[model samples]
Each structure stands twice: as structure tokens, then as C-alpha cells.
Target: MRIIAHRGASHAEPENTAAAFDAALVEGADGIELDLQLSRDGEVVVFHDATLARLGLRRARIRDHDWSDLAGLDVGRWFAGQATPHRMLRLTDVLAGWGGRTHLYLEIKHAEGRRGRDRHRELAERTAEAVRAAGLIDQVSILSFHEAALEAVHALVPTLALVRNVQRVGLLTRAAQQRAGLSALCVAVDRFGAAQRARLAALERPVYVYTCDTPAQFRRACDLDATAVISNGPAAARRWFAGQTSA
Candidate 1:
């Protein structure tokens, strides 16, 4: 099974920062997962939330700021023990830097309503364009909770592969998966079990579980025969897996 770093070893480093990705590699992760959002000026940036409130900037949203404005912000200051501040990265930059080092899973943040759909399409297009430009068509997978975004990506980059992050297992119908051309399905670690695993397996695609930060979650993922399990601390997960194997 592949051990992918959730937000790139995010437990020790600020999520989505280059440092976090570096840490993930050092921790022996097989792949790295990151989030993508559009900047006000039309740049595809690597960020998770719609707002900067987590960074202590209230009422400040990611889409409200231009890339130039967002690039200067110290995104790492909010994380404990992050001695150095990190800046937000653009998809162009991330692709250029980490394209072939390891597999990547790029998630488009969830959004709702008609306006959100428009934004999703734009993000999907831009993200797919960037990945194509970087020559990572075989190494990266575009993911989104919104099937529309996945559909947009499928239309733009038919061979790039797509992943759908489903909230409720039943919400992911065979037709929806077929429509998105999903290469895989991802679920929150807590939501997957033997029954759910069998149900997802019927699609005949790999199953990925996310935010597997704890040993139990990681173990459960393995038990469910996950193709890959995402976690915030790759090193710890490795140790846990090693212990299980040696026992």
C-alpha cells in the first residue's frame, strides 16, 4: 500500500507549504497530497481554506487577494514550532519544483452553489493546465469533493486521472464515478469499514482514505485493503506499520 502524506507531513510543518512537502519526503512517504485554490488574479495557488482566519486574518479570503498580495503573507507563523514563516505557493511553482519527485494528489477545496461551480471549473482548468505544462500527466491526480470540478478536469485533461472525495459513501453512485472518470475514491478514515470497503470495491477502482493521523486509522485503512492511505505524520505511520509487520 502507498503511504501518502496528507498536506505533506502537515503534523510537524504548516500544511501545504514547501517545507511540509520536504518533510514528507524525509519521512519516507510514497506520495504527497496538497490543496489548490485560485487567487484573485487568476493564479492557481496551493492553499486549503477559503479564508485566512486560520492564519489569524479574520474576514480575509483567499480569492479576495491577488497572487502578488497573497504571496507575501507569512502562512507558517500560525503553526506551533514553525520557526520560519512560509509563503503560499502557486501551482505553477509547485509543479515545476516537485513534479516527478513523487506522486501527487491535488484537491480542489469544496464549494457550493452556482458561483462556486464556475469557480470550480476555472480551478479545474487551471490546475489541469499547469499539470500538463509540467509534464506530470501520469504522476498527478486531480481531486475534489464536488463532482463538477472533477468533471471539468476530466474534460480538460482526459488522461491525467481524477479522484473524487466523497463525504457520504452512498453519495458516490456508479454513474457519478463513471461521469467523473474517477481513477480512485477517497473517504474520511472514520467513514470506511469492511462493508463500505466492499461497496467501494465494486467500482473496481482503488480506494484511498484521508487524514489517517492515528495508528488505528492507518491500520484500518490497511485492513480495508486501501491502495493508499493519507496521513499527516508519515514517519509515525511508518513506525506503526513496521511494528505491525514485525509482530
Candidate 2:
């Protein structure tokens, strides 16, 4: 199974910052997972929340402020430790920092209705453009909880793979991916079992699980036939994979 770093080895470093990404790479993660939002200046930035409040900034949303203001906020410090005084990083900066060294699974948080469909579409295009311009397009795939956002990206970059993030797993993810022709499905690790894995596998597609941290859970995921699993402790996954290789 592929081991993905949840928010860049977030258990060890700050989530979604350069330090976290570096930590993930050092921890032997196969890929890094990070969230994306649009800045007021139309730039794609890496962050998890709709607001900057969690990062200790006075602003509520990254979209509400221009890059000039957003740039000034210390996004790293709130996590404490090495992430102290973290800087809000541009998506471009992230791509530049870990472009060749790591594979990126980018989750777009900007949804339609809230941000409008057109704006979401534009965000998709802008993100794809940046990835292409950075020559890292092939190394990244897009994911989102918003169906429309994923659709927008699918329409723009049909060749690029998209993953569906379902909140309540039923047939929703399967249906969404079937309709959109998405490349992968990301479900909560606990929501799936062997039967579900077989069903998804029967369709000749891959399944991914999120935020599983322990070796036992990882082993369970493998038994469930997950194609990939995301975790904050990527080092644990690395050890598991090494064991498998040796076995």
C-alpha cells in the first residue's frame, strides 16, 4: 500500500507548512496531503481552514484578505515546537519546495455556492496552471469534498486524476466517481471493510483511506485491500512497508 503523509507528517511538524513537508519527506512518506484555498489576490495557497484564526491571525478567511496581508500572518507558531512562527506558504512555494522530491495530493476547499461555481472553476484552472507551469503537474492529483470543485477540475484537466472525499460512505463516493470518471476514492479508514474493498476493486479502480496512524490500523487497512492510506506518522508506514518487502 502507498503511504501518504496526512498534512505533511502533521503529528511531528506543523500541518501544511514547508517544515511539515520536509518532515514528511524525511519520514519516508510516499506522498504528502495538503489543503488548498484561494487568496484574495487570486493565488492558490496551502492551508486547511477557511479562517486564519486557528493560525492566530486576526482574519477569518484567507479569501477575505489579499496576499500582502495574509503573508504577514505567522501560520507556523500556533502548532508550537519547530513550527513556531510558521509562515503562510503559497501553493507555488510549496510546489517549488518539494516539487520533485514528493508527490502531492491537493484537496481544494473552495466550493461552489459559497465561492460561486465560476470562482471555483477559476480556482481549478489556476491551480492546474500553476502545477503545469511548475512542471509538477504529473506529480500531483486533485481531491475535494465539493463535487462541483472536483467536477471543475475534471473538466479542466481530464488527464489529471481526481479523488472523491466522502463524508458518509455509502454509494455516494462510488456514484460521484462513476459520474465524474474520477480516478480514486478517499474514504475514512473505518468506513470500509473487505467487502467494500472488493466491490471497489471489482470496478478496476483504487481506494484510499485517511488518517490511520498505528501499525495495527495500517495492517487492517492492508487486509481490507486499501490501495493507499494516509497517516500523520509516516515513519510507521515506512516501517510496515519495509517489513512487507522483507517478508
Candidate 3:
């Protein structure tokens, strides 16, 4: 199975930063997985959380701030040996720099609260526009736990691959699959089981397992026939997989 760096080799570098992405590429990762959050100004920025508390700013949300306000914020201090501070990256920046270098699995998170549902369509539209502008439609796949967001993106670009981030095996329904024109299944290592495998097989979609950081998890992914394995430590995971194969 192909090894993808989850949040770009996040175990070593700050999650979602350019530094982490660069490290992942150097480690010979097959792809990079990242999260997308829309700034107030409609810029799709690379970040995993909606709030800034984990990164040091208290009681602040990414959607509440414009790109100008969010830029230059230190995003790396929380990570070990990241005292130098790394700023957030925009989707455009990643596309311009890393596009075609490796596959990108960009996850679009659902906005908070009930009213946030309306905003998901906006995020999808902007994300679709950015990807089309980048001209890397073949190299990227948009992933999301929210079906509405996935469907919204699909409506904009029919050919772009959309992968549903499966929360549980039971949620893998035919209607959801048909609506999003899903190309694959991204299942967490915990929730994957015989039922999920059967459903995905029935749908004839490829399986991509996430956060496989342990040797046991890597072995399990192979047994489950994962097309790709996403992890925080791509370099270590690659070594473990290679060791298992050679043995």
C-alpha cells in the first residue's frame, strides 16, 4: 500500500505547515493529507483545527479571521523543536509549490453549529475554484465527512475525485455514494471491519486507511488491502512496511 503523510509528516514537524510537507516529500511519501479551513476572506488555508487555542491563540476561530489577520501567526511553537515558528499555508500556496509533486488528499471540515451547514457550500465552491485554477485536478482528491460538502464540490467539478471520510461502517449507504460520485473510501483504522470491507467491495471503491502509525496498524492495512495508508510518521511507517516486506 502507498504511504501518505498525514498532515505532512506531522509527528516530526508542526501539523499542516510547509515544513512538515517538505519533510514528508523528503521521506519519499507517496502523498500528503491535509485539512482545509476557509478564512473569513474566502481563502482556503491549510489547518487542522477550527480554533487557535491549540496553536496558542485563545478563543479564536479561523473562519472568524481574514487572511491578513491569520497570516504570520506562529503555528509551530506547540510542536517539539519548532521554536522557530511556522506560519499557516494557503491552498493556493500549496498548489503553486507542491502541485504535481505528490498526490494531495485535502479534507474539508464541516463548519461548526447548525447555521454552519449553509457555509459548507461556500467552502466547497471556493475549494473547487482553487483546485480548478491550480490545474491539478488529476493530482488531488477532496475528502470530507460531511456528505453535503462532498456533493457540493462534486456539483462544481464532475470529474474531480471525491472520497467520503467514513465515520462508521453503517454510514456507508448507496444513496450517499451515488450523490457524491465517490471514488474511494477513507476509513479510520479503528472503524474498519468485515462489514466496511463488504460494503466497500459491494460499491467497488478502493479503501484508504488513515493514521496508521504503528507496525501492527501497517500490517493490518495490508491485510485489509488498503490502497493507501495515511500516517503522521511517513518515514517510520515506510521503514516498518519495508522491513515487513523484506522479512
Candidate 4:
């Protein structure tokens, strides 16, 4: 099973920063996953949360601020004993820095509410452009929980790989997969069982489970023959897998 760094080895470094991404590569992750949202100026920024409060900054929606304003916030300070300070990273920064070196799982974060749905097309357009500019469209998979968001991306970049991210496996999830022409499915590790794994494998589409950090979970992913395992502790996962293989 492939080990994909969830938010760039987030357990070791602040999520969605350049440092974290670089660290994931150094730790031998097969790919890196990140979250994307639009800045006030229409730029694609790499961040997970809709607000900045989690990073110890004033509570503000990421979409409400310009990139310049977002960049000034010291995102690294929240993590204790961080070796170096990290700022927010742009989608371009990640693509340019580590695009071709490894696969990228880019999750398009939904906008704050109902009104944000209107910008899905523009988000898809911009994300497509960025991937094209990096010349890594083939190595990137666009992921979203919202079917409309994935549809928008497919319309913009038909050849790009798409994955339907679902918390649970069910009929609706299966329907979304067919409707979006998804290349793969990213399901929560706990919810994906042998039955679901067999079902997806039979369909010839890979199943990638997310947020797996413990050795037991990593082992389970391998035993289930998951296409990939997304984890916050890539280094630890790599170590465990290495031991398993060597043993």
C-alpha cells in the first residue's frame, strides 16, 4: 500500500505549510494531500480550516481575507517547539516545490456556506490552471466531498483524476462515484471494511483510506490491499511498513 502524507506529515509539522510538505517527501511518502480554498483575491491558497482561530490568530474566514493578509499570520507558532516558523502556502508554491517529485491529493474545501457554492467553477478553473502550469496534472488527483465541486473540476479538466471523499460507504457514495467518473474513492479508514474493499476492487477502482496514524491502522490498510493509506505520521507509517516488509 502507498503511504500518502495527510496534510504533509502534519503530525510533525504544521499542516499545509511548505515545511510540512518537504518533510513528507524526506520521510518517503508516496504522495502528499492538502486542502485548498480561494483567497479574497481569487488566488488558490493551501489551508484546511475555514477560520484562523485554530492557528491562534483572530477568528476570520479564510475567504474573507486577501492572500497578503493571510500570509502575514504566523501559522507555525501554535505548534510547540517548532524548529522553524512557517507561513501559509499558496497552491502554486506547493506545485512548484514538489509537484513532479510525488503524487498530490488536492482536496477542494467547500466555501463558508451556500453562497460559496457559486465559486466552485472558478475554483476548478484556477486549480486546473495551476496544475497545468506545474505540468503535473497526471500526478494530481482532485478530491472533494461535494459532488458539485468534483463535477465542476471534471468539466474544467476532463483528464485529471478525481476522487470522491466520503466519510461512510453507502449507495449515495457509490452514485457520486459513477456520476463524477471518479478514478478512485477515499473513504474514512474506520468505515472501510473488507466488504467495501472487495466491492471497490471488483470495480477496478482503488480505495484509499484517510487519517490512519497508528501501526495497527497501517497494518490494516496493507492487509486490506488499500491502494494508499493517508496518514499524518508518514515517517512512522513508513517505518512500520518497512519493518513489515523486511520481516
Q: Each model's TM-score, in the order given? A: 0.94, 0.89, 0.94, 0.92
lDDT of 2 by residue, 1-247 (tens): 7889998989888899888899998988999999988877888888888787876565577777788888877777777565346788888898888878888998888643465667777777888778878877679988877777777766766667788876565765455555555887777766666666666676666778887887767866786677888999899887877898799
The digit string of per-residue lDDT tens for model 4 on 29-86 reads 9999999999889989998888888776666888889999988877787877886778
**Per-residue lDDT of 1-247 in model 3, one digit per residue for the tens?**
7999999988888999999999999998999999998888888899889899987788899989999988989988788776687998999999998989999988998888565877778888888889998899999999998888888889998888998887676776743455746888888887775545555667777888987998778876876678889999999998998897799
Tell me the whole-model lDDT of each prediction, alpha carbons only. Answer: 0.84, 0.79, 0.85, 0.83
Candidate 2 regions off by >4 Å? 57-59, 82-84, 112-114, 173-176, 179-181, 244-247
Q: Please report the TM-score between candidate 4 and the true structure.
A: 0.92
Clashing pairs in 4: none
Pairs with backbone N, CA or C atoms under 3 Å apart (clashes), candidate 1? none
Question: Number of clashing residue pairs in every model?
Answer: 0, 3, 0, 0
Better of 3 and 4 by lDDT: 3
Ranking 1 against 2 by TM-score, winner:
1
Q: Name the regions of candidate 1 deviating beyond 4 angstroms.
A: 111-114, 174-176
